[model samples]
Target chain A: MKNHFRLGLFIFITPVLLWLLLLIIVPHVELLLMSLHGKDDMGRTVWTLANYRNFFTEEIYWYTFVRTALYAVIVTILTFLVTFPVAFYITKIVSPRLSGFLTVLLLMPFWVSELVRVYGWMILLRESGVINHLLTSAGLLDAPVEMLYNDITMLMGLVYTSMLFMVVPLISSLEGMDDSLIEAAHDLGASPMTIFYRIIIPYAAPGITSGSIVVFMLALGNYLTPKLMGGKNSLWFTEQIYNEFIASFNWNQGAAFGFLLLALSSLIIWAGLKISKQQLGKALS
Target chain B: MAPVLDIQHLRKTFGDFIAVDTLNFQVEDGSFFSILGPSGCGKTTLLRMIAGFQQPTEGKLLIRGRDMSRVPPNRRPVNLVFQNLALFPMMNVRENIAFGLKRQGVGAPEISRRVDSLLERVHLSGYGNKDISQLSGGQKQRVAIARSLVLEPSLLLLDEPLGALDLKLREQMKIELKKLQADVGTTFMYITHDQSEALVMSDRVAVMHNGRFEQIDTPRNLYSNPATRFVAGFVGETNILPVRASSSAPLQVQTSFGLMLRATPVGNCQSDTLDLFIRPESIILTPAESHEDINLFPLTVQNILFDGSNTKLLATVGQSDHELLVALPQNQQFAHIGKGDTVPAGVHVDSCRCYPRGGS
Candidate 1:
């Protein structure tokens, strides 16, 4: 029995250990070392804080980073507001057969790659694309309107891309809720608005918090949606990191930006958990 | 004063199925009224209508002399304690108990005072800070009750709140609920499938079968004098015998198993055919008096089903395959009776209740 237990443990755990060490920890360690080193005056690699210091000193870098963070937060909020009702409707309002069908419908778009999905939005929203062409021909507009390459278009793409992540968790949470709780609240002299806020929202808080975190992280790290949909004005922070490594040939600066994004996002998530009074360990389960 | 609740010709039907077929009953103020029925018997539908959760397809439902047909559940003056004890899992005991009060625009201090008093009344004073998950089954049961009772509505509806507890806890909560209802002086309209719960805690019980109430009366009368065959069969353990009447004045009936029995006919038993319901405890083992009206029979002890405080004698009536369940009186005098013992058994003539065959 002991040997069997040991063998089962080895079978379950060895792959996870190998994955953490090779894929995550090893790469992160290499990036940290790369981020810490910089070329000195003599053109020799030296341990320096110059790359980290440049992020604080430069106006465009910090401004773009803050803009990216702001957009990610906005996208997260928009996704929540848009998808919360859909989750509630699917879980509580719809019949079981239709709920299943609606869930499948939600997942059908995710079958295609994210790049292709974003490109699909581009095809519809571009100046000479389907939406503008229809508007011009249908007499809604005298000329084709430039609807793409703006913050709104970019935010729309981000929310659209991350909707399923928010919705799936919200649906799971709402599904576990007992309908009797809502009735009980109503029977106890609670108004519809009061019941929604006091009962339903509190019950769905964990799902909301986790979904928001996931959507915010996705929007922050996203390069494709903002890059394609957002034209010259899209000063997303990831583009800065990409420009450092590929355009400027500065791996050290890119690595520093990457580490900074990770640290700042982690700090924001931790602060959010504190404000919402949610435990990450509890929410994940 | 008007009754706490009055339902007149209330009917609810879903598609072709009648869930609650014209329920009409009045719940007196400060009285414990219960609707007792088996699962899927439309008792829940009746309770939901009273609580304003479901609208009656047809009829008038009045609460405190006001028509509630157009009222939403939130606007009604009734609060329901759900079967699963739907306490808000996200809130602590204090917040849960204060929820209804908060919705009513009650001040914080007043809410706290009322909640604390109710918590004390439910024997959960110090447990206000505890999360709902932290409490045991019985504690949660009390919290659910307290959550509704703190509102002090015109009527409190309990939907099988004790159904989730273990046997011992259920028995314990039954007494606690009865006492709590008495102390609070609020009318309670509780519904449960458990006859014991309904009988033990309720001042009056409506025995419902299908979509209609077969009988609604005091628990003692419901047990001893059930109005219909469904109520007699569903209320408690009773030996149902298909017997034919032999006499008119005293009303004695004869069983098909070749055993003669004396029983009173309930309702109009115009037809000779009757379904007699005799309680297990009423079956007297060896009558001392020789009366002309009483019918006696010889029962051979087939088996002794010994359940402590509820021991029963499984006896075959007069060497026939017809079985009779007799409550074994636990005493030194009857201790000698065992398996395969031929004992003289007879039920009192008045104790036997008979209804017309095939009549609900």
Candidate 2:
């Protein structure tokens, strides 16, 4: 009877498993296969390790990989700094009516596509855009300020786009926290700053961790922001893959770049999980 | 000795609805004081105001002779054991106990000594490193006490601290709490809707109703000589009989039981309308032939129930509108009285109190 029940459960879950296998598992496996295989002049498949070897030997490729990882980390940190205070205000300080209005206002920008949001940043930061126009009119600048097509703009776009992800989880975790704990800490003679660092931060650690992980992953995989904002000077790893596949038509090189980004993201996720497990064990024990 | 904490005309209102109104009391030092009422009677609100968690709309609250109306909870020399305990889940038992000491900038060795001493005091010495979730309900209760007591706050507020425990555990904790309080000598302000818990644990209890304190007195005083109809009815079971003051005698009430009960009138009232209160245990069941006084009434036993230590009887006195719910000791034989048996019910007039109707 148990065997039959188990079989029934497996049958019920088979479709979802098949969808994952087809869309996610298969594509990743194909990417790995392509990374190992070489392409001929006519785009025919051939076996070779030349692309991987070339990638290891080149400084630019390794630099791009490191730079992208660094960009993602910076974006994650900046997003958290901005989002945590806002989430806290919404959850604790503001009146419910005002908070609900502010929540809708914060989420309004998210309704638009990430591509459009990036374009919005481009318009604001461009040489002849509103910021430059304001500066020039105010006589702060003799010419239109050259703000766009740089790493700063790219980082700004990534942070803005991924901010909502951080805020939602942070608000949820903070909202779930018992207010009595804070009051108890105060009754114990803790100052406001002490209460924040010792009690509030530790209580909301799970939200912080989960939010950072999401922001980091999203920022790392993003290609549009760097491409649009950084323009020709930008040397993001995703751009390198884009150049290899579409511009250069080098599928083998593109596959190698894809594999490297995948490996770096996986390493980060694994490290994050390890730290989370350690913190969780400490919290539980 | 001076009052440790004094609240005068304390009132709190949330928009149109009043939570606590015109509450006045003085808590003596080194004494356990309780605010007892049903839920929504503002007992917890009163405690919260005392702890500086809530500000009264109108009142003066003084702690140790200093006005603490504007003082915040943290600055006050007081600690609260929250109803849920609210122990720091991330910290171990020792860490939780040491938290307050650390906040006060106590030295490491002193913090350790205090934590260990508190753990032993609460009878959980070896469980210092255990996680909060690992401890049972009773253990959690002890940890909460240890954490609050370690701070050595002059005043400690407990909001139904043992309310979550099972009956047996709650009973045990009441005794443990009293012993702990005796050892520590901290004035504890406890809040509970459970009258028995309040009666067992407090040196004095203030009964609250409809957001105001009805009366404040010792348990025995409040039970035996309640100032209001609500207090008399709420503290324990009381049989309230509607009465009309007769012009024939001063302090004499005409009850429906066909007798003029000579009872002490509560408060000043010129009207004849009053409510006379008699405890169920105060009414004596006797044989009709043995009836002794004019206060005796002939009644028929309508029902009898065996309630563990006692048998509760439902008796009707003549053609009265209300039936009497009387409790008799299980061992006491009652003249072979069963359902439909005639009996004489003697109410001790001295034990009955007369109060103005609805003066609560």
Candidate 3:
């Protein structure tokens, strides 16, 4: 019986262990080694801090990096504000059957690929697109105005793509909460607004933190949305890393930039957890 | 003085079903009032309406003589201790207790003072900084009560808050809650399905059934003199014998097993079919005392339920299916009586209570 149990455990764990080691751990280790070295004046392999120094010394690289992080934080906050009411409506404000239907409605957009959904938005928002044509014909606007290739459009794409991640966690956490808590708060002379901040938000903090972490990571690491929507004006940090790797064939510099992004994003998350007084372990659970 | 809560002609309907049917009651100032009923009996609906979480379909609810028909729950001068206690898991004991006062824009010092005093009242004086999860079940219950009481609302509603405790804790909390209510002097509107809880705590209890209150009287009166058949059956353990009322006397009833019993008459009971209720304690074991014209019959003991003070004997009529529950005398009066022993049981006229049977 013990041997059979061991066999079952091996069957379940083998693929996961192999996948993590080969796909994630091995490649990341290789990249960390690659990131530590750069070519010398002698045009041979050498170890140097030049690759790391290049990031802080250059204004565009550091500014774009900071901009991307800030944009990601904004996207995460926007997604949370938008998804909280949607989650509350689904879990508490509606009947079970209606909430089930509403959840399906929210999930329907995600059934299509993210690229396809972004392209769908692109088709609507571009100049001479369906929106501009309808607006001009209805006399809401005199001429077609360029709406794409802007920071706002990129952030919108980022928030939209990250919304489902925020929503699922919010819904699950909100569902686990007792309705009596809200009622009890109200019974104890708490107004609706007070209850929202004191009771609902605190109860759903773990969900919010987990969702924010995911949304922030997704927004920062996103390549397609900023490139396609913001066009040439987009100075996303990942784009610069991509430029270093594919355009210039600078594998060492690309690896260094990649590690920097990873380390800095993690540092930001740590600072955020400290500021918000939430433990990552609690949020993950 | 106006009652703290006066609910008049309150009715609540959901689609085709009525939850609370045109109910009228008044909870006096500084009194402990309990609405005792089984689940789905609309006691919860009535409590929610009074708390202002729900609106009555047609009626007026007055709190301290002011109409509260249009008021929301938060605006009402009331608080509720929920069944599961609903203590904020995120906050410490002090924060949970001071939540209502904080919402009311009270000063920080005032909130702290009230919370501390209230915590002391509930016997958790120095444990204000402890997390809610750190407290035991009984302690959590006291915190939930202190959380509500700190607001000093005109009325505090408790929705079976003691139902979640263990049997021993429930028994302990029952007495503690009664004393707490007496100490606080706030009008308590407690809702529970536990008959003993209501009888032990409340100054008056409203026995609800089928969306309406069948009896709203003192606990003693409600247990001894239930106004309706539902109340009589729901309040306590009783042998309800379906019998045909005899036209020969005003309160004479003949059971289906061919036994006739006389009861103290109720006014204007004109129905021929009635349910005669006899409490288990009312049935006296034979060979003890002789009485004036009481109904006596022989019963075969089937089983002895030895539950300490509440021990009872399960018996049936001689060679018949008429079962009777006789409360065993705690004084060892029937100590020698065992199963299959034939004993005579006597029920006095006053002990036999009768209510007219209703239609299907």
After superposition, the stretches of candidate 3 with alpha carbons farther than 4 Å from their true spots are: A1-18, B287-290
What TM-score fits each model? 0.96, 0.91, 0.95
Candidate ordering by DockQ (highest first): 3, 1, 2
**Candidate 2 chain B TM?**
0.91
**Top-TM-score structure, candidate number:** 1
lDDT against the true structure, per candidate, is: 0.90, 0.85, 0.90
Each candidate's chain B TM-score? Answer: 0.96, 0.91, 0.96
How do the residues A19-64 of candidate 1 rate in per-residue lDDT, one tens digit apiece? 9999999999999999999999999999999999999999999999
List, residue by residue over A75-111, the lDDT tens digit for candidate 2: 9999999999999999888887898888889999999
| Per-prediction interface RMSD in Å | 0.9, 0.9, 0.8
The better candidate by TM-score, 1 or 2, is 1
Per-residue lDDT of A232 in model 1: 90
- Enumerate clash totals for all models, in the order shown: 0, 0, 0
Candidates sorted by TM-score, best first: 1, 3, 2
DockQ of 3: 0.87
